[model samples]
Target: MPVVVVAWVLLILLGWSLVYWPHLPSGFVFGSGLDSSARASWTDAVYLSAVTLATLGFGDIVPADGWLRIAVPVEALLGFPLITAAVSWVLQVYPALTRRRALAVRLSLLRRVDTVGLVAGQRSVLAASVLENLAMSMAQLRGDLTQFSETYNVRDADQNLSLPAMLGVATELTEAARRSAVPDVRHAGELVEAAVGDYLDVVDKQFLRVGGSAQKIAAAYADDYGQRIAPAVSGG
Candidate 1:
């Protein structure tokens, strides 16, 4: 997103510079006491445009003519809001992205524990506690998925840590728990499965209402998981 904003800024600067280039001789001026040999070129126009848009008044260049006087300040005024909005968007998005990554990590850990327990046939109290904790984590993750679906605006395919991926992980963990001989683990797995189902329903409803890139991402993720990751994780 920041890259998009930067591209837009560059394009804006280029456009304004091109518009001002032809008018430079009559409408633009360099600072006083500069050499007479210094004349406005395309490069100079571009530099001035950047300076004005960034509101970086180095004062080495100035607009001398009437129309340019209005134009330069208008560019400077636009600069303030544009830069502020970009910074504010970054500040808002970064934390949300960080939280999503953290949740993915936590789910990965839970899946690992459950897989190990299923393989080892462990029936200890510690295993039960782990199952309980996994169930709780799945519940929390469901809520997080709801928030993510509600708040996130799909910008691109760059965001790979999505609700669908997390759902796949949860499904694997539930299957692991179900295969275990321990009754408590089986019950916990059922709880996780139920929570996951509810969350998936919400995701489906959201996809139906707001069908776009997000829905495409979810469908692609599900297909990939079903064909590749699911068989590997399920030992099929």
Candidate 2:
């Protein structure tokens, strides 16, 4: 996001520079009473552009010519909307990002337990409850991911909260179920696997539409999940 903002600022600066370039010699007035003696260099023009774009109006530089006099105000007018849009985008994405992180943490808890622990005869009830809760969490996460994919059109860089992480969690739950002698625990695991599969189908369609790096990332995730997690989970 910082990179995006910086790129926008640079583009704005370039546009302003071009607008001021032609009238550089006689149109700009610098403070400290150098209005007549000071010629507008590229640096001075850029400084004025930055000030106007930021709506700073530091009173250190002024536009003297008729064209520049009109241009400065227009630039200032554009500044507010551009800044507002950038801030709005960040604000809108923050909640989705927070939810993604929270889901990742919840899913990570499944990693701490071994199959034996989850499948034990005495702990069968606890294991069933855990798998049920995990399935519910994955369902909620699937909704969040769908919303995120629609909004962003790109995969998140954070592996912990990414599609792969969800796959890992689902696979782990399935493996535990297969290992368990208890029928309830196995049923709970099936629920989680079905939910995760549906979620992956949604993601697959989204990535296919987005294409390029996003498609590649989705493919890589599938490969990793299939090769490493699926075999163990399926008892193959």
Candidate 3:
């Protein structure tokens, strides 16, 4: 990500350097210390570009032409705010991913503790509430990923924090609830399943680009994140 940001800044500087190159010494006001040479070299253009983009107009050289005076400060404007926006984008992404990983951990703990209470055909209101909450969480996660596509490439250092690793657990748990004898639990499960399915569709459509069933897309997502989907039980 930093590479991309740097590349963008460099490309902008290079483009503006080319623009300034054509109008060298003739278009610029030079301080007494600068050489009064008739011809300017490419390095002079690059140096000018660097200073301008850095917003440090070192007085030794300044734009003289009307258009260049406007252009130089424009590059300065791009300098501070453009990089600020990029840094802000990076800062925002992790908070969203933190929430995503937190949800995965919550799902993991639920799976470790209760195997049957959620999906064992029991008509518990608590189970229904859990399912609804999971659905809402998954829905919010989907929205985050959609808005910030770059988060898909971020790798979780911890297995417990990897959403791809626990996504199946969510689906299967929701599946069990959908099969519950209780109507409320089943409805809640259905909503969560839809939520999970939408997230899967987004993975396939935006990032994976491997069109197929949800299972295939989920597998591709896991693989990209350096994980493998855990196999479901035969009956599950």
Using lDDT as the measure, the top candidate is: 3
- Quote model 3's TM-score: 0.80
**Model 3 C-alpha lDDT versus the unseen true structure:** 0.80
lDDT of 2 by residue, 154-222 (tens): 345554445464456556567678777788998888887777666566666655343344324445555
Better of 1 and 2 by lDDT: 2
TM-score ranking from best candidate downward? 3, 2, 1
Ten-residue region with minimum lDDT total, candidate 3:
227-236
Better structure of 1 and 3 per lDDT:
3
The residue pairs in collision within model 2 are: none
- How well is each residue in 1-236 modelled by candidate 1, as lDDT tens digits? 56667887888899889978887666766677765255558887898899999998998777888888998898888778789978887676666656655655555554554454452366646655655665675566556556555344432232234444544666666677778887777787777767666655555565544344533544554543342222214232
Clashing pairs in 3: none
> At residue 126, what lDDT does model 3 achieve?
84
Alpha-carbon deviation at 117 in model 1, angstroms:
8.3
- Runs of candidate 1 exceeding 4 Å displacement: 1-4, 32-36, 115-167, 173-236
How many Å off is the CA of 115 in candidate 1? 9.2
Please list the Cα RMSD from the true structure of every candidate, rounded to 1 decimal place. Answer: 7.0, 6.3, 3.8
Error of 3 at 97 (Å): 1.8
Q: State the lDDT at 209 in candidate 2.
A: 45
Error of 2 at 85 (Å): 2.7
